[model samples]
Target: MPPKVQQKSKEQKMAAAMAGGKGKKKKWSKGKSRDKVDNKVLFSKEQFDRFHAEVPKMKLITVSAVVEKLKLNGGLARRALRDLEAEGKIKPVLISRSQRIYTRNVAEGDDE
Candidate 1:
């Protein structure tokens, strides 16, 4: 007696590919291309100022915390901090392994 043969439909083949059970996705033919999306944007000075003002109040805030508070993206938040540090406006106070702490340079009049 011979063993039975099985046939799979096109939909089944596609399903397997979609589920990653098959190898890598098939590449587009020559002359075909995909568009790349860019998610980074330059942050404005106003946003940086807002971050600076808020820094004195927060004993410590991570990068994600600033992003959520300012309603800005991660890139913008990072750029703002970098610029502030470059201009001697703010200082970085490193916390544990993955945490970054920030504090403002208290001005002469800010105490009173």
Candidate 2:
């Protein structure tokens, strides 16, 4: 005699797929919801200009300082600073595991 095998219904198959084949349900994290709200707020030109102007005065600019000065979230501040670095407006001084410091880019012959 052969053993009997049980077959899954359409809903059961869907449930399995939704649970990533693990039988355990996945839950959304609070950080994800907060990120959705942060995405809605765009970085403005005026804010960028202000950041640019402020960079030279400070010997080193870190993400926390930018966040405090501009009243922006950590992720947004980091992204904006990276964008400015990519644009050649600023150059990084020191990058460590915990923090990165940046300074304004100075040309070869320009006296600061």
Task: Give the best candidate by lDDT.
Answer: 2
Determine which window of 10 residues in candidate 1 has minimal summed lDDT.
103-112
Ten-residue region with minimum lDDT total, candidate 2: 32-41
lDDT of 1 by residue, 29-105 (tens): 69967775443365568865777788545655567777768777776777667776677766677846656666665
Q: Candidates' lDDT values, in order?
A: 0.68, 0.74
Clashes of 2: 0
Residue 81 of model 2, lDDT score = 82
Error of 2 at 101 (Å): 0.7
